[model samples]
Target chain A: MTIHHHPGKERIDAVRAFNRFYTRQIGLLEEGLLKSDFSLTEARVLYELAHRDGLTATDLGRDLGLDAGYLSRLLKKFEERDLVERATIEADARRSSIALTKAGRQAFAPLNQGSHEQVATLLERLSAAEQDRLVRAMQTVQRLLGGSAEPKIPYMLRSLQVGDIGWIIHRQGLLYAQEYGWDETYEALVAEILGAFVKSFDPKWEHSWIAEREGEVVGSVFVVHQSDAVAKLRLLYVEPSARGLGIGRRLVEECIGFARTKGYRTLTLWTNDVLTSARRIYEAAGFKLTDEERHHSFGKDLVGQNWNLEL
Target chain B: MTIHHHPGKERIDAVRAFNRFYTRQIGLLEEGLLKSDFSLTEARVLYELAHRDGLTATDLGRDLGLDAGYLSRLLKKFEERDLVERATIEADARRSSIALTKAGRQAFAPLNQGSHEQVATLLERLSAAEQDRLVRAMQTVQRLLGGSAEPKIPYMLRSLQVGDIGWIIHRQGLLYAQEYGWDETYEALVAEILGAFVKSFDPKWEHSWIAEREGEVVGSVFVVHQSDAVAKLRLLYVEPSARGLGIGRRLVEECIGFARTKGYRTLTLWTNDVLTSARRIYEAAGFKLTDEERHHSFGKDLVGQNWNLEL
Candidate 1:
C-alpha cells in the first residue's frame, strides 16, 4: 500500500491554509494560550513538567524539539521565578534533573483547565454526533500524516446498519479508483453486489462484520452462503488509515471463524492480484490459492485470483 | 445556528487522543522538530521573526501565545547567539523592537524548509486525490472547531454528479437525526424524493445545484417541475460546518435563478418552521409564506410552512 504522490502546488497551499486556520483556532496566535499568561511553548513546557517527574534538560530539549541553550535559558527563568527546581541525579551526578516546583504546579493548573474549557467551548457548538465527526476528522488528519496514531478504542465488529452499505459503496468506489485507477464501473459493481446482498439477506447463514473504531467504520467483510457446505467472503477491506493494525488479517479470520461456526466446510474469496495487501492477509490466514485468470475489467488488464480455506 | 453541547467523557478522551497523535505527527514530541536544533517553540519564534519585521516582545508574546517573561528570555538567548538583534522603538522609548539577524535567517531557512518538506513527505504517501481528502478533513476539523476559518476556495455550484444524491441523502439523514432528533423516516422520505427526481430528471425544466468547497459538497438544492409555469424547490440543505458562510442563501438564490431561467413564474418550497436558520435564508430571499399546517412527521409533532416566490 505504498502510494508515492508528488504533491502539487494546490496541496501545499491547502496544507498551509489549514496550518494558519488551526493556529488561530487553537489560540496559538493569541497573546496567551487559553487567555492564560503562558505562551504556547511555555504552556507546553509547563504541561510536560507537570505531568512527568525528574525530566532532564536533554529530555525536555529533545522531546520539545527545543535548542539546549534556549531550553536552559527558559528553565533558568522558571527557576528564578520559583516555578521550577533542579536536583543532581544520584546515579548520574553530572546530569541534573528538573521538576516543577509548587508554584509551577499552581501556574500549570489554570493553563490545563483553560485548555480543557477551550476545547469544551469548541465542542459546545456541535452535537454529540458532530463532535464525534470533528474528532474523527482530526484523527483522520493525524493518521494520514503518519505518527503514533493509535485508535483510542480497539475496533469492534458489528452488523451493518442503515447507510453502511451506501457508505461502503461510495468509499470503495472512490478508494479503488484513487488507488488503482479503476473507473465508476467498480463502484457500480459494488453497489450491485450490496444491493443484491441486502435484497436477499439471510441472517442465519449470511452475515457482515463492520469494524468500527469510536463509531467510524474502519473495515468490513461479508460472508455469503455459496452452498450448504460453502461460504464466500466478499468485500474485505480495511481503510488505509486503519491498515497496519492487523485489521485486514482480523477481517479474514472473522470470515473463517464465522464460516466454521456456521458449519460450512469451506470459505472462499476472489480478488485481483494487484490487491497484494489483501492477498497477503488472505494467504496468512491459511487460505490457499485455488484459481487464477486474466481479466479485462475496470479499465485495466489484471490477474484475478481465488483462494479457499477448508473451514 | 447556535448549538449547545455538553462535552462527555468520550468526547474529551477523543480530543485528547487527537492532540497527542497530532503532537507526535508534527514532531512536537521529537527531540528536534524537522531534525533541527530548534525546539518546536524556537522554530516558531524564528519563523515569526523571519517572516515579520520589528516585532516587540509584546507583539511576540501576544502573537505567539507566549508569556512576556518567557519570550524575553528566549529573545535574549537568540541575541546572545547573534541570531536576533533588538533596537529601541522610536515611537515608544520604553519598548524594544526585535528582528531576525542574518545569522537568524540562516538558521531559520533550514527550519522553514524542513517544515515544508515534512508536510510534503506526509502528502507524498497519498495520491493527489487522497491529498485533497486529507486537507479537506483538516479543514473540516478547523471549521467545526470554529476559528477565523475562512474557506481558501469559495464554494462553487455545479450540477449533481454520481453519488451526490446518495451523499445528500446520507448527510441529510444523519444531520436531521442528530440536530432535530428525526427518525429514519426522514431518510426514507429523502431517498424517495431523490429517487423520483433522478427517475424524472428533465434537463430542460429541472436542475440541481451542489455547492462545493474544494471538491467536497457543502450544500445542495433542486428545482423540480410541478407544472409548466411552476417550479418546486426541494431538499435544500447546507452542512453545519458551512452554515455561517451563507451557503444556504446561495443555494436558494441559485434555485431562484435557475427557476427564472427555465421561465417558471412561481418557485415554491416547503420547510419546517423549526429550521430557523433555513427559514431566515428563505425569508431574506424574498420568499413569502403562503401556507402553514400543523403536522406529525419524523415522529415529531411540528409545523410545516410553505413559502413562495414569484419570478
Candidate 2:
C-alpha cells in the first residue's frame, strides 16, 4: 500500500516468475493455439467476428488489441478468401461493417469446438470442487489487476461461493491471531464447527451468507438450526481491511431475516468479549446479552458472552 | 471430433466470449497492469531479465516476443538509467549477456509486490477448498493449451491431486451414460462413495491413486479403511479416450500395493457385470469373485458382483 517503499527483490521475482509460469501455462507462446492453423491473433479476430454480427476494422482492432494497419490487412485477406464481406453502414456510409460469410462461420466452427474440448480436456481431470477453485482463483486474479473502477468490496450479500468457506476459516484464524493474540485453537474451533455444519447440512434449516465487496468476500455469518424453534448464529466476521463498510451490520440483518422466515422462535450466539465489533453488530440487530462467563480457550483467558434475540 | 462436419457458429462465439471475459478478467487490457506505470510489455522484459542470468538482448527479444529493434532500444534505455549492465560474450562478440543492476531490481520490486498483492487480495477471500479449485483450474487451462509433446495418457500412476475425484466421477458418469445408458443413479452412487471418503479422509490408512498422462488425469482408484485390518477399493475408473493403455490395470495394481503396505488382510469392491474392462483389470490384479446378485440399478437390471483380494 505504501507506493514509495522499495519492495524486496524476492517479491518482484515471484511476480515475474508467476507471469512466466502463467504465460507458458496458458500456451501464449504456442506456434498454434488449440493445434489450429490460426495464430493466436487471427484466432482472436475470428472469434470477435464470429460472436458479433457487424464490426468495422477499427472496432476489430480495438477489441482484439491489434494495430490499425495490421487489422485492415488481415480483414482484406479475409475478404479475398470469401470468408468476410463488408457493407457500408446505413447510418454512416464512411464506415464499413464487416460480417463473416457462411464459409467464415464454417471455418471458425472447428476452432471453437477445439478450444472447448481443450478446456474440457483439462477440466475432466479435476473434481467439481477443484473446477470451482480454479475458476474463482481466475476471478480473483482478474478482479485484482483489472482496474475495475468500483468498490473492491461492493457491500453486497450473496449466497456462499465455493472458496468463501476456507477463506473465512483462514482469515478468521489469522485475524484473531494477530488482533486478539489468540492461537490456532481459534482456527480449530472454526474448522470443527464448519466441518460438522457441512457434514449434516440441512439447507432448509441452515443458511450461510457471504458479504462480498467488489467481488471479494469481506464478511460472513451462518444461521444453523438448533431445533425447529431455535437457531444459533455462528462465525460472524469481517476482514479488518473491509471494516466500517456496514458489511457486519448487513450480515447480521440477513441472519435475522433468515431466522424469521425459517420460523425460529429465538436466535442465540456465543462470542468472546474481545470481539466487540461483532457484539456491536449483534446488539444493533436486536440481540440482547443473555449471559457472560469467564473461559479459558484459544490460549486466552477471556470473558465469553451469549446473546439472544426473540423472534 | 470430425473435421469435415461444420461446427455451429455459436460454439465459436462462445469460445470468443470466454476469451474476452478472461482477458478482461485478468486485466490484460488495463492502461497499466496493477495500476503501475510500466506497460505489460515493459514489465515482461523486466521479468525476463530478472529471472534469467546472462541473457542477451537477442534472448530477451525471442523470449518476450518483442521485436529486436524495440528490445535493443529498451535495453539502451535501461542502461542509461543504470538499471541494467551488459557484458560481451567471450566466445561470441555478436552477443552480450544482460544483467539487472540493483537499481533495475529496485524499479521492478514494487511492481512485483503490487501484482502479488493483487493476486493475494483475490486469494484471501476464497475458502481453502475454493482456493484449491481456482488454482487447479488454472493448472488445467495451462496443461491443456501448453503443448506438452508426450503421451496423452502415460501408463504411470501418481498420488491423487485435488481435482482427480471430481474428474473420475464425471468421467465415469458420462462414460457410463454413453456406453451403457446408465442414468444419474450411477453418478449419485459414485458421489456417495467419494463424499464418504472425503468426510473421513485419513492419509495413512486410506490412500488414493491417480493416473495421468501429459498433465491430464486418465484413471483413478481409492483404497479406504473399512477397519484397521480391512480396506475397501472404490471408484476405479479410466477415461474412454485413455482406454487401451493398461491404465486400469495399473490403477488396480496401485490399490493392491497400498492395501498390502497398509497391512490390510483383504480388500473388497462392488461392481456391475456390465463393466467388463474393470472386471478384467480386477481379475488380473488377483481379485476373485466372492458374490454376485441381480439388481435393478442405474436404470438397468444388472448383475452386481463382489470381488476380494486376500493380501
Candidate 3:
C-alpha cells in the first residue's frame, strides 16, 4: 500500500526540471563570459574592482565570498594584466587595498552592461504583477532555504541587515491578518517596533542593516546605546521564511561586534517566551534571561522577558 | 530615497547565504568531491553511468544536464580511468551504449552511499512532522523556481508508473481537499484514475516512467491504446511543486513519440478547462482543442474539453 507521499512525485520531478532550467539560465558560460583577453577569474576580479572602488584583498575575499587562496591567485592574474593595482593601507600595512586600472574599468564596462541587459531582458518578459509575484516567491524561497543554520559568517550576517525589517513588518502584518484575523493588533505592534527604533536612532551610537535575498528583505537587526555601562541589542527580527538559516544568530553576533567596538560593558534585549529562537540565540551568545512579566498586548496573552549579557 | 527595491535585497542576501550553507551541507567541497580519485568531470560521468546504465553519450549529456563538449571530455576521462566502457548497439551502430566498469561501480558505491548519508543526516535533524513540512516547503520552492517554459524534443512517454501515479493521486487529492474542500471527490477521482490504468496497462503497446530526483519519486505519465488507428494520452498529471517546468509538455511529447512508434495516426487527451497550462502544452505540441462540454460531476462547475492531434 502506498503511504501518503506529502510532497508527491510530480513536484519532485518539477523541481528536477527547474534545477536544470535555472542552472542553464543563470550559470554563466565560461567561454562566453571569458574573452581571449581575460580568464573567468581575471574578469571576476576586474568586476569586483570596478564595482568596489577600493577594497583590501581580505575585503575582496569577503565581499566576493571567494576562498582566500583562490582569490589570491585571481588577484595575481589581475596584477599581471596591469588591470588591478594593489597598495598597502598607510594606517594598516597588513591590509592591501585593490583598485581597478583605467584599462580594467574599460574592460569591465561592456561586460557589466551586457549582464545588466540580460537581466533586463529576462525581467521584460514578465508583467509588473508577475514580477512582483516572482520576487515574492523568490523571497519565500530564500527565507526557507537560507534560514537554516549554515556556517560562513559574512553572507549569513549580511542576510539580516536593515531593509529586512520592512519586509518583516509587511509580511507579519499580512500573514497575521490572513491567519488570525488580527490585522489591527499586528499592525499596531509593528508600528510600535518601528517607532521604537526611529526614536532611539543615533547615527553616532547606533547602526542598522536589512538583509535581502532575491530582491526581498528577510531579516534585520540594530545596535543602540543604552546607559554608558551598556549597549542594547534592538529590533532583531528575521522573517519566518528566513528562520532556519541561523540568520537570527548571525544578527545577534553582529550586535555583539558593534557593542564591543562601542565599548559597552553589557548587551541586553527584550523578547518573550514565544520568541524561543531569538532567546536561544541570545543565550548562545552568553546572554541570560534576567526579567519576566505576564502581559496581554496583541490581543493575546504573552510572557514578556528580557535577556542580558556582559561584553 | 529608496523605493521598494526590485528583488528585495534581504531575500537575495539570504539566498546567497543559503547557497553557501547548502553547498557545504551537500558536500559540494571543491577539494573533496571535485578532487577525489576521479576528476570532477569523470565523477559526473560515473554518476550518470550509475544512474543510467545504457545511455548513449548524447543521451548521457542530456540526462546529466551537461554540455555536449564538456560531457565529451568527461567521457574521455571516464574511459581513461576504465570506469566507463562504451560499445555500439547492434541495432544502431551510430549510437553507443555507456556502461560502468567494475572499477566504476566500485568507486560509485562509496560515493552514492556517502551522498545518501548526507541527505539522510540532514533529514534526521527534523522530527517526522518537520521532515514532512520541509518537503512541502521544498515543493513550494521548486514550484516557484522551476515554473518556466523552455523547449526540447519529447522522448519516451511513461504514464502512471507506480511511484508517479502514487504521487499524482496523493498530491491531487490533498490539493483538491485543501483548496476546494472536496476530499471525497478527489479521493474517488484518484481511485478511478488509478484503477483504469492498472486494468488497461500493456507494456507491449505502452510505456511509463517514474521521474526521480534527489532520491525521491516526483512524476509520471503514460500513452496507451485507443482504436487501431489512434492512440490516447492518459494519466498526464504533474505535482503542484513541479508545475511550470514543462513536465506536462515533456509527458505529452513522450506520448507523441510512443504513438508514432506504434503507428497510430492520431493522439488525443481529455482534460478540464481549469488546467489551462496543460492545455497550453497540448496546443504547443500541435494538438488542437476539438470539443468542449460543461458538466458538474464533482459538486463543482466544470468544463470538459477534448484535444486532438494528427500524427
DockQ: which candidate is best? Answer: 1
**Across residues B181-202, which tens digit of lDDT does each residue of candidate 2 receive?**
8765565456556645655679
Per-residue lDDT of model 3, residues B1-311, tens digit only: 11222443444444433333333332332234553565544555676678766789888676555689888777787788888888989999888898999988998888655544444544444433334445555554444344343223222332332223434455555555565554334444544444455555566676665554333444566676768787878656664444555667777777898888888898988888887777788889999999999987555788899989999
- Per-candidate TM-score, chain A: 0.66, 0.69, 0.50
Query: Each model's fnat?
Result: 0.36, 0.01, 0.02
Candidate 3 versus truth, CA RMSD in Å, comes to 18.6
| Winner on DockQ (1 vs 3) | 1
Whose lDDT is greatest here?
Answer: 1
**Residue B153 alpha-carbon offset, candidate 2, angstroms:** 15
Error of 3 at A174 (Å): 17
Model 1 chain A poorest 10 in a row by lDDT:
A23-32
Q: Model 3 over residues A41-90: C-alpha lDDT tens digits?
A: 56556666776766888876764556899888877877787777888789
Looking at model 2 chain B, report the run of 10 residues with the lowest lDDT sum. Answer: B1-10
Q: Quick one: ranking by TM-score, best first?
A: 1, 2, 3
After the best TM-score superposition of candidate 1, give how far the Cα of residue B189 lies from its true spot, in angstroms. Answer: 7.0
Full-model lDDT for every candidate: 0.78, 0.71, 0.60
Clashes of each: 7, 20, 37
lDDT per residue for candidate 1 within B268-300, as digits (tens), equals 999998999888898899999999999998879
Model 2 ranges off by over 4 Å: A1-225, A233-252, A270-280, A289-306, B1-51, B54-144, B148-264, B269-283, B292-306
Cα shift from native, residue A133, model 2 (Å): 9.4
Q: What DockQ does candidate 2 have relative to the true complex? A: 0.09
What's the CA error at residue B226 for candidate 1, in Å?
8.9
